[model samples]
Target: MERDLSRQELTAETLVLWEKTRMSLRNCIKRVMRSHGVEDHKVWGTVHAYAFEIVKLLGTIDALIDHVTKGSSTREMHPWVRNPLRVATYEMKWRDLKPAIATSEAVRIISERVGDGPARFANAVLYDVEEVTLEEVLEKAEDEIERLSIEYSHPTWYVKHLLDLLGRDELIELMKANNEEPVRYLRVNAHLKDPDAVILALEREGVVVEEDPHVPLILRVVEWNVPPVRTEPYRRGWVTYQDKASAAAAYALAPEPGERVLDACSAPGNKAAYVYAYTCGEVELTCVDINPRRIEEMKRNFKRWGVEAEVVRADAARLKGVLNGGFDAALVDPPCSSSGSYNRTPEAKWTVKWRHVRRYAEGQLRILRGVADLKPGRMVYSTCSVTVPENEDVVHRFLSHEDTYSTRKPDVPVGSPGFDRWMDRRYRHHRHMIRLWPHRHMTEGFCVTLLEGG
Candidate 1:
């Protein structure tokens, strides 16, 4: 008979594998580019199962560190010993695991990888770590930022940033939404089949689906007997997994039949695919990405969705020399901090810093300026971000500089309006922009700003 390895043992081993194999979640844009197929299949499978557990740990890791070390700096401990203690603390506080078991397991791993001295320190810390609970910490939170950070499993700055834009209740609501698991939204391929037929087919496959009332082609998977990817509709290219917010972007862009559309920054191609889906494959699209690998990836994505696009390798930030700009409508899904998407990609939640928002905002603005092209009519400036620096702030600064363009409200509007004053910047047509809250929409948080040539 084989012994069932304890959670602590599994967690310790997982941490070792993670330290070696995990991808950088510093921001959203780069994470999508890297091919993250782990060679060690066993480690891969085990680590994925504990992803939520890891996320739960991240929210409270610092607090646990503080408590364990008698409010001393965690920087003093070696990372090898410190990490296992984080996992052990998470298991003990959140997972209902015993303190002795969690502490013992952590000590065992630290002793093996680090040294006896550090392991002894780990042992003492974890004993104190076991005393700290998420509720207990929340009960004694110093301020709103501290409370929301611990409660939602997000960084303190992230919670602090939103407070100015939202009230205490609203901020808490948004954070709560970010911490929960997201629904898998799939876009029905209207070009291939009818909406009812696709829903029926998915239902027959033991996949419970609910179509979005606002967007005809988008469906929300309520339950799944088999994974949506394994379903026949997905395999046949009759439906593809996409966010409702992305599908909303396609509708907002509203490319006409025989219109020329440029999907700038279209790698991983969800928005690009939706352009074709919404246009019923009638529009001519030029899918652009700077990276050669991303260009290849976009090609594959277009093929998978039966999406026809003129895939091109071009730097979005500077496109003057590469190609002449005479695009009718450009779907500029430019890079942002991916603030809205951190909930789904929890790794990014930990890695994201306040500084990233401004950097991403600059990059997004530069790409927007390039994609503005000579013959622009309406360009959709969209991001999977709710932050001001990435969303409204970028649009605010761009509209000020670009004299030819003005704020144009996206059609198919059913969302909260963008803020007039966020921190310091006050947008002119703030109400014209749309901000989709995940808590309200049950979709990935998105900000879609449209610019039209005068």
Candidate 2:
């Protein structure tokens, strides 16, 4: 009977720890992935499972530490104590739970798991931890690494990398943004409604949407929990749920009716649907992705939009064996570090590390090399990553190394220019790459580079 009561409280505390600890494990997994080149879909299931174990273990340890530290008042200890103490403090401060309840839950979870001594230690420290403010605790932190870790609840290295990319102010905004639930964006499926008409339709339906100047047909939904997609307009394929930035790729491709299009790495067929719709179903589209599971999902989406395309599960880098060189256009939305889309999938930021970004860049280069072989005069090579190494830099390296490929600007509404020096160095004759960001354009990060064949 007593065990059941204790278990219930531990469970409540575990829920709080679960969210915090899962975030930690996600950061760790991303760090290790680049060394090994693992994808998120493969690791996310493990992350979900490991989150429970991590919280349970951390809660147990905090309890144990408190047991050892008893008799000491909260004022005596340094604000930054053990990991579990820090975690418990997060629960009390940020989570809005009763401090005593938070402390007891940590103690219960620890004592039940680790026997008496460790549990006593965790209990004692947690009792002393209730008074410490997150800001005060961070001030007591010895270094930037420790400070950012406690302050943002992120791994130290990840915070440093963000600081390197975005500097101090922007990085803080990015981190705070990631911690919140993301806004959902939609791409007006052009097959159903032209961009202007779609906006009017959404407004008429009481769905507030703002145009993304950087992206062609992307719309940002101001109010969440409103399932605008379920509305008659959306049900009739007027708009598709996609990041505004992501929609830029297919729109840049700008397929014309009766054109032959190849979409490499196109599973979960948002782009394929966009291709068929944007071209008004005039183009013959061939879509492919390596994962069969994603292919099935793409098929479902394709069906939903009432667009027909030849879908295959195959590697884009090895498509020479299967697809001929007759394709007039191709879209390579290959695997990437979802740096730009992190706003939509906050869980993604947790999974990104410096190494994974490099691996994605290398893999994208190989995919681009394969794309060059198709002899496409116009192709879109895009990623949902805002990282220079993955977007402009990847295109630069590809053009520098691949003798047959060049660059061009498409006919669509122009967005941001490509990186200044990189373009001058690689394609001085033409600069047609487009960069999109959430902060500027109110969408996820996306880049679309137009390539002209040799």
Candidate 3:
């Protein structure tokens, strides 16, 4: 044998470059689900083998496209036959591949970009999805929360409002921790570096990270071989990619040094550059945002976190005459229905529902009643959102129409308190709110509170 036909012509030219890189990830998830309706697995983050095969097909590739279109309505197909039959039913049910090589590579990418009558209707619906298997292709959902929304592809009215706010054993351990894959916190730019020299330069670039006996100088990559944004202690800033509950809401909105804060929806400014890098640039912040391109991406994230502040664009929920009343503290962080970061933005749990969380808790209670005219002797009101009509019913209707505001409790050190029977109220300073909890503090679902003013 001539070297077994030259190793079968190099395995058919490596399956023609893995079927043209899996049809360019099904046309980049059908052009980000047809221009941002969802499906942006953050552009498969630098292709870690297609980011571990598209985040382990989170929410199970829309439950393997409603079990290969059996229950129809992928808005009646045709994003070139619904994103190449959702990438050939996620490579024949979660990468087991070989359903005749995922229906002949989605009919050779719909006969090279749609032709031959949509490649014979994507080869007659992937030849009836390669004769179903992944648990005999179920999902004819009709109840039991649309069969746990096609068994956890989510969005059956968000599993019937998380089965009435988490009751089926913590909504089945928060829907199996929102379908796994997530755990990569880090924040030690300890006011410009030195948490033991940024953990010995992120373990000489292999990135191990760990320290976090409750948030300060955060860190928790726990294990990595690379991709702490291709480390170098995240390029000399010593570290940043935040989310230890958004750096414990900038150390529980401490923001001191010559005060005068007010972040109020500051875009791209992660907690206003972690409150001017934990007040070293000495707060007098400002930042606001009604988008002048997110105030130029919060002035390029306060010049890449060196952090100085004062960007402003206006309309922090109608800051009467684009602000004037002075401040000593305020954070706000409006916009909600993130549903506690849907386990790392899982296409924001099918683009957030419940009328977008009652229009994002009525625009976060009109930016908490227009930032209480900055009579802000401190205010926080965060929200990655774990819902309670967008966190404690928009912080109990902004402390029942600001009786000069109230609630306090946030000495940080981890969270979970608010939600003292929400939905027919019963809050008594909902233990001064904090709430975190992606299945208890692997954290992502967030909600802070802390107010004062009077």
Question: Which candidate tops TM-score?
Answer: 1
Choose the strongest candidate by lDDT: 1
> Tens digits of per-residue lDDT for model 3 on 1-454?
2221111122222223333354333343344334434333443332223323433343455555557566675556555555556666666766677777766766666666567787776677777766755454344555577656555566777677767867777876776786676687877656787688888888888888888898777788888777787777677666778788877876787877888888888787877777776666776888788879768866865666577767777788788677786888888888777767665656566546788788888988988888886577878888887778777777787788778878889899788787677557777877888888788788788888888874
lDDT agreement with native, every candidate: 0.76, 0.66, 0.69
Worst 10 residues of 3 by lDDT: 1-10
TM-score-best of 1 and 2: 1
Query: Over the stretch 1-454, how does candidate 2's per-residue lDDT look in tens digits?
Result: 2222222232333334434465434444444344344455435344433333333233223333333355553234332223345445556654666888877766655565555665577676666566544455556567876565545554455567556656777766655554444567787777767878887877777888887665666788876334686577688777878865567778887787888999999978888777787677788989989998788888888877788889877788888877877888889889997777654544455456878888999999999888677787678998987777788778878877787777777655745666554323543522678776565555566788888773
RMSD of every prediction = 4.0, 8.5, 18.1
Clashes of each: 0, 25, 1
Question: Would you estimate the TM-scores of all the predictions?
Answer: 0.88, 0.72, 0.35
Candidate 1 lDDT by residue in tens digits, 85-195: 777777676677888887888888788778899889888888777666667767777987887787777888878888877877988888777777787899987888888
Q: Record all residue pairs in model 3 with backbone atoms less than 3 Å apart, i.e. clashing.
A: 340-385
Q: lDDT for model 2, on a 0 to 1 scale?
A: 0.66
**Residue 85, model 3, lDDT:** 63
